[model samples]
Target chain A: MTRLIDVENLTLRFSTDEGMITAVDNVSFSLEAGEVMGLVGESGSGKSVTAKSLMKLNASNASYSDETKITLHLDDGPVNVMDLKTSKDMKVVRGGAISMIFQEPMASFAPAITIGDQMVEQLQIHTDMNSKQAREVSIEMLDRVGISDAAQRFKQYAFELSGGMRQRAMIAMALSTKPKLLIADEPTTALDVTIQAQVIDLMKDLVKEFGMGIIFITHDLGVIAQTADKVAVMYLGRLVEQGAVRDVIRNPAHPYTRGLLAALPQLDDLEKPLVPIPGDIPSPLERPPGCVFNTRCEEKVGDICSAKVPDFTNVTENHRAACHIYTQGSDK
Target chain B: MSDDVLISARDLSVHYPLAKGGLFGPKPVVKAVEGVNLDIAKGSFFGLVGESGSGKTTLGRACLKAAPITRGTVRYTDGDVDYSLTEIDNTQLKDYRTRSQLIFQDPYAALSPRMTVRDIIAEPLEVMGLTNGREETDERVREIAAKCRLNLEHLRRFPHAFSGGQRQRISIARALVSRPRFVVADESVAALDVSIQADVLNLLRDIQQEMGLTFLFISHDLSVVAHVCDHVAVMYLGRLVETAPTKDLFKAPRHPYTKALLSAIPSLDPDDPNKAQKLEGEIPSPTNPPPGCKFQTRCPFAVDKCRVDEPKLEHSSTDHVVACHRWQELME
Candidate 1:
C-alpha cells in the first residue's frame, strides 16, 4: 500500500474556561491511498478535532504542544502539516490537497447561495477551471453522488433541496476540488437512517472512484462496519484499538471495544438485551491518570488499570490495542 | 382484551392554517398529518419512523390533544375511561392530558437548566394537578427517579450538571410522574452517544415492563426502532407506507420505502458487509409533492403509473400493511 498521510505523536489541547483540556492526546495513525479508515469514538473522543488538526482548523482557544508532527506524503514530496504557517502555504494542505465534509451539510453551505455556485466557488479556488468548466464539473459530480436533474439542481438553493440532496451536494463540492485526503466528520450523523445509508454507500463508491484516503469519523458502529476497511477506536482522546474491520469486530481485545460492540443493538441478537458500559464518560478535566475507560470498564484489573497507562500490544499482525490483558500474552 | 387498546387514532389529520387571511381570501393550510389510522396496544412499544417533516410528531401530539386536528377521529381508552379525541369536550381533554404525556427529543432543550432534577421531574405533576400537595408530588417524583436510576443526591443539582443520558432519564421521569398510561417518546435517545444510547434504551424497555405502560416511541433510527419497539410504523409525506411487527419488518419489508429504509442502515459487523440500498433522489417536499407516490421521485421500481396515481396502504399479511403499487412485484 502506498503511504498517503502520516500523523505521529499528534497532541492537541484547548484552553477552555475549566482548564487546558487535551482534545487529542498523543494520537498517532497513518492512512494509505484508497484505504477507508474508520475513526470510531463517542463524543469528546477527539475524532473530529484530530481530523480538523490535519488542516489546522482548530479554534482560537486551541493550543498545540511541541513534537506534534503531521506529515503528508504528496506526489511532489513530504510536507509537515504543522509547519505550514501561512494560509498561502497551508492552501496546499487545505482544499487544494485536503478537503472535508461535515455532519450538517447546511452549515458547510451558505443558505443564500445555490448548491452549484458553492461547488463552483470551491472548485475555482482550488483549480484553474473557468466558470463554465467548474459548472460542468460540479454538475457531473452532483450526478455522480446520485442527485437527479443535475443541471436544474444547479439553480436550487440549499434549503430548496432535501436533507439527502444537500448532503450529496456537499459531498460533490468537497470532492470537486479532488483532494487526495478527505476528512468526513460524522457526515451522516444528521441524516435519516435510510438517507444516511445512501450517503454511506455514496462515500464508499466515491473512495473507489476517486482513490483517496478518508478519515471517516462517526459514533455509528454499523456505518463503520459497512464502509470502513480498517478501524481505529478512540476513548477520551486516546487510541484504544486499531485493526482490520473484520478482526476488530470479530475479536476485540480491549474491554472498551468489546463493551461498545455489546452495547450495539443488532437484529440477529434479540435474545440478549443491549448492555451499555456501566457509567458515563468522564469529563475531559476529570480524565483518568491511566486508562481512560477504567471508570466504565467491566474488566478493570485493579490498580494497574488505573495507576499505569497500558502500552499498545499487538494481538495480531495488523491489529493492536492498549490494554494490560493483551500485554500478558506472548509478544506477536 | 379491550384494555389492550390504549390509544387508537382513526383517520387523524392535523392541518395548520398558514396565517395569511387577505381581505377576501380564505386562509391557506399545511396538512401535516393527513388521514392516519393507528392503534397502540396496551403495554406494547409502538415505533413511529419517518424523515423530517413527515408529521409523525404531530400525529403523536394529536393523540395527546397537543395539536389541533382538523379532520378524522382519535379514540383514547385506558380500559377505564374512553373518549373520542375529535369530539371530546375540554373537561375530558384535560383528564386525557394527565393520562397521555410527551417525552421530548433534545434533552437539553426539553429540560430547564435553571431547575434542579427534583423540580424538573415534579413540574408535570404540579402542572396537571395530579397530586394533592407538595408531599405527594415529591414522593411520586422520588419513586420514578429511583426507577430511572437517577441519583437522589444529584436531584438537588441543576440539569447543566448532568450528562445527556442523565438529562434524558430526568425527562422520562418527569413525563412518567403524572402516572400517564401512555408516553410519546419523540426521538428520546437520538442525541445520545452509541454506548449511552444502549443504556437509555435498556432503561426504557425495563421501565415499560415495570410501569405496564404503552410507549409510542417515535424515532428515525431503524436499528433503534427494531430493538425497542414491538410494532413499527413507517411514515413518509404524511402517510404510513408500512406497519408491522418489528421483527417481520426487519426481516421482510414489503414497501419499497421500507425495504429502502432497511437497506439504508449500515451494519455494525465488519464481516457482515451489507451495502446500502441506493435510492435515486431526495424525498419531495410535502407542500409540492409528486402527483402520485411521494416516494416515486426516488423509487427504483417507479413506473409511469407511479408518477400519476397514488397507492393505498394494503396488507401483505395479517399484521403487515404496505402502501405501494409494486410491493408485490418487489417481493417477487
Candidate 2:
C-alpha cells in the first residue's frame, strides 16, 4: 500500500486567555491509501485538533511545534503541509487533496444558499469543473448518497432537508471533491442511530470504491470496531495506544484503552457491570508532571508512573501501548 | 393501575399547532407524541429508545408534565398520592414538580456558567422551596454532591472550572437534590465520553438503588440503554413500536424496526460480519406520517397490509408487546 500521509511529532497548542495550553502532544500516526484510521478519544483528547492539523484548519490562536511535520503524498510529489503558510498555498491540501465533513452539517452549509449551489461551489474551488458539469456531478453524488429526488432536493436549502438527509447531503458534498484524504470529525455523532448506521455504511462503501484514506474521529468504540482497519487511542492530548482495530480492541495493553473497552456497554454481555475509569480527566491548565493518564491509570506502577512517561511497547507484532506495565524494567 | 406501577400513560398524545399557511387555510399540527401507552414500575430503570423526530424526548417531557398533553391521560401513582397529569390542579402540579425531575442532555448548556456547583445544585431546592434555609440547602448540596463523587472543595468553583463528566454529575446532583421519587434523564449521558459516560451511568445506578428511585432514561444509544435499563421501549414517528424487558428485547425483538435498530448498532467485535438490516430512507415526516404504519416507509419487511392498515400493540410474548403487522410472520 502507498503511504497517503505521514505525521511526525505533531504537537499543537492554543494561545488562550488563560495561557498557551497544549492541545495535542507529540502525537504521530500515518495512513496508507484505502486504509481507514479511527482516532478514538473523549472530548479534549485532541483527536479533532490532530485531524484538523492535516488540512491546516486550526484557528489563528493555534501554534505548532517546530518538530511537527505533516507530509501529504500527492500525485506530483510529497507536499510539506507546514511549509504551505498562506491560504492560497494551503489550498493544495485543503479541499484539494483533503476534504472534511463536520458533526453539524448546518454549520458547514450556508442557510440561504441551496444545497446544490454549495456543493457546486466546493467542486469548482477544488476541481476545474464548470458550473454545468459541477451541477451534474453534485446531483449524481447526491443520488449516490441515497438522497431521493436528487435534482429537486438539490434546489432546496439545507433547512429544507431532514437531519439524516442533511447529513447525507454533506457527505455528498465532501465526496464531490474526490479528495485523496477525508477527515470525518464525529460525522455520525449528531445523527440518530438508524441514520448513523446508514452513514457508516455509506462511508465504508465510499472508502472501498474511492480507495481514499479516511481519518474517522469518534469516541464510540463500536463505530471504530466496524469501520476502522487501524485504531489509535488518544487520552489527554497524547497517543497512548495504536494498533490494528481487532488486536487493540480484543486485547488492549494500555490501562486507559482497557478501561474504555470495559466501560462500554456491550450488547453481547449485559451481565457485566460497566467499570468507569477511576478519577476525572485532569484540567489542561494543571496537566500532570509526568504521564498525562497517570492520574486515572488503574495499573499505575509506583513512582515511575507519575515520574516518567512510558514509551510505546509492542503488545503484539502490530499492536502497541504506552503504559508502565508494558515497559516496567526495560528502561532500567 | 397495578400497585407496582409508578407512572402509567394511556393513549397519551401531545400535539402543537403550527401557524395557518394562508388566512383561510387550516393550521397544521405537529404530532410530537401520539397514542402511546407505557408503564414504569416502581424503582425500575426504564429505557426509551428512538431516533430524532421519533418523539422519544417529547414523550419523556410529557411524562414529567413539562409538555402540554393535548389528548389522553398520564397518571403518576406513588405510595399515597395519585395525580392525573393531564388535568392536575396548580397545587397538585406544584407538588408534582418536587416529586419528579429531568436531567438534560447537554452538560455544557444545562449548567449555568455563572452559578457555582453548590448554587446550581441548590437552585432546584430553593425554587421548589424544599429546603428551610441556606444551611439546609448547603448540607443537601454537599450530600448529593458526595453521592455524585464530586469533591466538596469544587463546590465553591464555577461550572467553567469543571469537565464534562463533572458538570453532568452536577446535573444529576441537582436533579436528585429535590429528592424526587421519579427522574426523567433525557439523553443525560449522551454528551460525555465513553469512560465518563460509564462513570455517570454507574453513579445513576448506584443512586437509583440507594434511594429506591424510579428512572425514565431516554436516549438514542441502544447500547447504553441495554446496560442501564431494566425495561426498554422503542418509539418511531411519535408511536411506540415495541416494549419489553431489556434482555428479552435484545434477545428476541419482534418488530422489524426494533430488529433493525439492534442490528444497526455497529458491533464491537471486528470479525463480526456487518449484517446490519440497514433501514433504507429516513423516517417519514411526523406531521404527515404514512397512512398505516409509521415505520412502513423504512421497514424492510413492509407489506401491502402494513401500508393500508395500522397495527395495534399485540402481545408477542408474556410481557413483550410489538406493534407490527407482519411481526408473527417475520418471527417465523
| Candidate with maximal TM-score | 2
lDDT of 1 by residue, A1-332 (tens): 78999999889999988889989888889999999899999998999999999999999899777988998999999999988888899989999888999988778789898888888987888889999999999999988988889999998999888788888888898998889999999998888776776787789889999899999998887888888889999999999999998999889889999999888877676656788988899999889988888988888767878888888889999999999777655543
Per-candidate TM vs. native? 0.95, 0.97
Query: In model 2 chain A, where is the ten-residue run with the lowest total lDDT?
Result: A323-332
For residues A1-332, could you state the per-residue lDDT of candidate 2 as single tens digits?
Answer: 99999999999999999998999999888999999999998888898999999988999999999999999999999999999989999888889899999999888899999998999998888889999999999999999998999999999999999888998899899889989999999999988777888899899999998999999999999999999999999988999999999999988888899999999999999999999998788877778967889988888888988898888888889898888887876767
Candidate 2, CAPRI quality class derived from DockQ: high
Error of 1 at A192 (Å): 1.9
Return the top candidate by DockQ.
2
**Chain A vs. native, model 2, TM-score:** 0.98
**Model 2 lDDT on a 0 to 1 scale:** 0.91
The best candidate in terms of lDDT: 2
The window of 10 residues in a row where model 1 chain A has the poorest summed lDDT is A323-332
